[model samples]
Target: MARKKTDQKGDRLESIRDAHNAEKMARTTRMEDYLEVIYELIQHKGYATTVDISNYLNVSSPSVTKMLQRLSESGHVNYEKYRGITLTEAGVAVAKNMHDRHGVLAEFLMMIGVDEDTANRDAEGIEHHLHPETLKKLEEFVKLAKNQGLFR
Candidate 1:
């Protein structure tokens, strides 16, 4: 029937959309990790090189180079071979957001009596998956706890 065909077409489209979304999310996660590391390295040192990133992430230099090339093509980073990497404005914005999220999550864990080491480890695992609303709530909670002298 026509209705059956329509439904099948809709299902096929939905499946494709779901696949696309999943792939996009995976790429975003990887990009976020790289941006976070690059932000830290730049803050600590003067710049971030592929070798520095590979060493920091414990990944291969080739892998780092490949990702950097992808990031550069995507406009998140400006990469020149044999030179260092620098984030563009958009990349800096993403990195700053990620850094703030990490801090807020880590602070919340610490407020709840999680050990410093454990809090850092847990925050790293948990930060990327949190929704914006959840992060906002966590930030508010951290602020409230700090105001109430709950943090030592």
Candidate 2:
């Protein structure tokens, strides 16, 4: 039988590495999602409100407020209570990046015969985690496939 609790004591040495990376991805994902919604709202409607964002994202109003406050603190948006929300330049850059990523992934999936709605949904799910190199290759494949009339 496996030794159930070996007597070797836990290490007394220092921790191996920093703890920033895991949380970084989570935080970045949240930031990107919020920014993407805000960007779409602004693009189509000329304004973004907490209620609109909450509705688009399907999060509670309070949750949206809390996140907006955090984003305000981070220089991603100009948020004022009951006023309005606007993405700063930095925020616009990130949001536009996510939007482009979504477009590419969805188009690629559709090129592979996935339906449009499912391609878009799956793109939203996975767009945040793609590496730059992998995304570049997929983008290239989609571009060439379209141009060469291979997937059409």
Candidate 3:
């Protein structure tokens, strides 16, 4: 009975991990782009208004409104129409994770001699497709580079 419980627990953990990864993998580029923008808006401005997001993303106001509606409905964002938008807890976690990935990729590229502009652009494109393991390795590489005073 105890052995069976341990096995069941392990299986549950594995299932949860798989589900989390699937959610990450299932995100479309459009969703990621929106999340990234929302993350930035929240970080920089403390709150995200439709007008602010539209201007920051250079997207039309109508497009921003449509996406925000979808995001709010999907539980990624909290909306109150006139009040503004905030990310739900799960959405906050996802945004932070994606932003960290972008920062890590950008730093790695810069450490390896890519120009800042190119690194930023490339990181934005590459972070979405990179496997978690590859990102782990890149993160380690960045840490090692920093330890070696490569940034100085």
Q: Give the top-scoring candidate (TM-score).
A: 2
Residue 141 error, candidate 3, Å: 1.4
lDDT of 3 by residue, 5-44 (tens): 9999999999889867886768766777888888888899
Candidate lDDT scores, in order, read 0.88, 0.87, 0.86
Q: At residue 62, give the lDDT of candidate 1.
A: 95
The local lDDT score (0 to 100) that residue 105 gets in candidate 2 is 98
State each model's C-alpha RMSD to the native: 6.5, 6.7, 8.3
In candidate 3 the C-alpha lDDT for residue 33 amounts to 80
Residue 143 miss distance in model 1 (angstroms): 0.6
Q: Which pairs of residues collide in candidate 3? A: none
**Candidate 2 accuracy as lDDT:** 0.87
User: Model 2, residue 56: what's the lDDT?
Assistant: 87
Better of 1 and 3 by TM-score: 1
Compute each candidate's TM-score over C-alphas: 0.82, 0.83, 0.77
Point out the worst 10-residue segment of candidate 2 by lDDT: 7-16
Of 1 and 2, the candidate ranking higher by lDDT: 1
